[model samples]
Target: MSAAEELEAGGAPTNFDAMVKDMVRLALSSEYARVPIRRADISNKVLGERGSKQFKVVFEQAQRELKRRFGMEMVELPAREKLTITQRRAAQKTEKPSTSSKSWVLSTTLPQAYRIPSILSPAKAPSSKAESTYTALYSFAIAVISLNGGSLAEQKLERYLARMNVDTQTPLGKTDKFLQRVCKEGYLVRTREVDGGEEIIEYTVGPRGKVEVGSGSVAGLVREVYGFGQEIGDSDLEDDGEGGIRPTQVEQSVKKDFEMRLRRTLGMQPLRDRRAADANGVDAGAGAGADENEGRRRSSRRPAAQSESDESD
Candidate 1:
């Protein structure tokens, strides 16, 4: 503490505040004393037990300086208080993250326009009966494929949605509708299961579906088996470099014309999985045969040694 400051304070015992005042003066005197606030330095470790509260003081002082120098307020949000899709969509219309105290949004601008013409126009209304039928059929398709380990099932789907805290039942129905429309327009081929009791149908990803779903430049089953890049149009689809687009789109962007153009060139023929299973079986058999032959050779060798010993005796 400064002697002058002590005298001004009527000789009150010197405290850390006086020390901070001195440091501030020194910092002001030296241009090299200025430094960007390192987030790590403000952590508890560097601050020490008694000094733990020092960061808060430094932070407040920095905040005061910033406000004074720029005439602006600093805004920060906790991780969980981040943005939502609907909120993001609404914000994007103005080309800005929402300044609402309730919203802490992130923004991304698109580099190109790959808009398909039909998706831009309003879709024709289908009869309710047709919608229900399509929904049921597609749901069945999803369930069946998922049951065979082709994709995630109901349980996984529910868990995923819950983690994201997204309950878009109406939007989910739209996904079913989009899948159904693909099934209708694309050259989907159905084949009987190897067991013959029921058929397992695999939908071939056509060219239109490729443009709609696949992240790659090529079309067909590759896209269905693989996936597309992120940031299609204005929103983000979960791209795992595989076909399952994440955070399913609320609207179907690929039109019937594009969907129809995709040819069903794969997944219709009988699956060749049996070849893999057969090869595995053959390898197991070869190993077993070698073990058995080795045992027989050892037994024969033992008998020959016994005979030779008996002759020597």
Candidate 2:
């Protein structure tokens, strides 16, 4: 344990300045994948793939990495057992659905396992360098948005570059390029916002983006990444973690989440270069939005068709 961390843990200054420095460390770490240590019926004697002590060591190491990289204070591992029926019922009763927000019965089914076959398989390191690029960009982008509240615009990119101590005008076209790729991937769809009568592209996450948890299992991945993908930083609102999640962790998690969602929504395709189409035909302007709307309409109309199809079958 570093002396600084020990001091902070031992009730030293718990201010944002001290915390922000730690957050930057996490943002800069190259090997900091936020996978959780699952504590189920594997055995009390073993923690990770090793014995209890070794497992504890590995857990602690991962925790330390999480702290050092993302300013996350060590949290107690999750309880192993499933919730009792009564406990679940009570919890369900207390949970009120968000009535003010719009609702849609979007299909929750996953894509066919064959398309992005690797994500569903047993853990294996990605074979190619390109496979990990989205993850890194996701991490960095999260750090930018979470720690620094800004839209994913060119100005935001410049601000992020400055924070990283890189030249503001550096030719880092990859980030923008990735954004374009995401739009093409169907994980994101862009809208034309009229500003002074000039249409500017604004991007939003899609359903596939909702499932983007990288190689990490879906369990707890949203909490680890976006602090709960639905909301940005509400985990800190509760004191469940003795004091709940720190603001820094919440920020990092949300930002990471947005990136993952962006990747998932966009898919593994190379970003499209459609800036030229900004001046082109209405066909170019219609884009995936029309296709998506048609898809949703078709999907909604399919249950009857499916029943008939089943009857025919």
Candidate 3:
């Protein structure tokens, strides 16, 4: 009789081919496509009772049919290693802990047959050439901002450049130009204000800068060229207003001291470019002052010509 007919007639399924197919389907449908078919469970499921001579015979026949038809023989699952509380603690102490300790525990407890994909792997280094002066400057600026937790004061940046001996010939002018280009090109966001009669400019990573840094491309390039790894832990920075972290007090102090040394040794002064000052509305008339003065002088001379023409007339 067919398996279905035998089931409907209140008898255990005796069709070896049908029984093997059912068991294979059940196994494949289970988690990891492998089911533990215990003898008691099988007896209960197939015969609706445990310990039946006829059920045992049928189960053996099904196993043989499965091996013959599908070349898949049922094998016993390996015994799991059980550890006592003391043993578990000892094992945990021996294992090197990581940030993903919880995940490590879950991975250890997972079935041996099931494999979990690795979380940490060596990142492929970005394919990049030796950057030009502008590219290098851009990369350095972005890297500094990233190292400082994504935002930096303009004074701090200038100090960093001076200390690094960047553009030793004209550090002030070069730094100004670099900042302008990066800000204009959407690689950095420059916010300027006048504080106590001094123009203050602050920089933050722009969209492009964030993308490069977040993808580890900028860090990779920095590592390759500067031999300095730019990676920073998330916990190191304080939360800033712009959804990014700010540099620590120690970092700020170091930069401040370096800036002082640069000032004393190299005479690095904070440049106040007229155009930049005007752009920030700090000194709106800075650029036009000379032009306005020249216009006034010409206007003063123009009245004399007008008087000469009147006298001639």
Question: Each prediction's TM-score against the native?
Answer: 0.19, 0.26, 0.28
Residue 31 lDDT in candidate 1: 13
Best by lDDT: 3
Clashing pairs in 2: 26-69, 142-255, 181-271, 185-266, 187-265, 187-266, 225-253, 226-253
Per-residue lDDT, model 3, residue 185, is: 50
Residues 235-313, model 1: lDDT tens digits: 2323666666555444334422232232122121111222343466642213221111111111100111111111110
lDDT of 2 by residue, 59-137 (tens): 4444455445433333221121212344456656766633221111122122222213243222234333333444444
TM-score of 2: 0.26
Candidate with maximal TM-score? 3
Q: lDDT per prediction?
A: 0.30, 0.34, 0.42
Q: What is the Cα-based lDDT of residue 118 in candidate 1?
A: 28
Cα RMSD of all models vs. native, in order, equals 29.9, 25.1, 32.8
Residue-level lDDT tens digits of model 3 in 149-203: 5568988998887776665653234667767766765557877656679876678
What TM-score, to 2 decimals, does candidate 3 have? 0.28
Least accurate stretch of 10 residues (summed lDDT) in model 1?
A: 103-112
- Angstrom error of the Cα, residue 107, model 2: value is 12
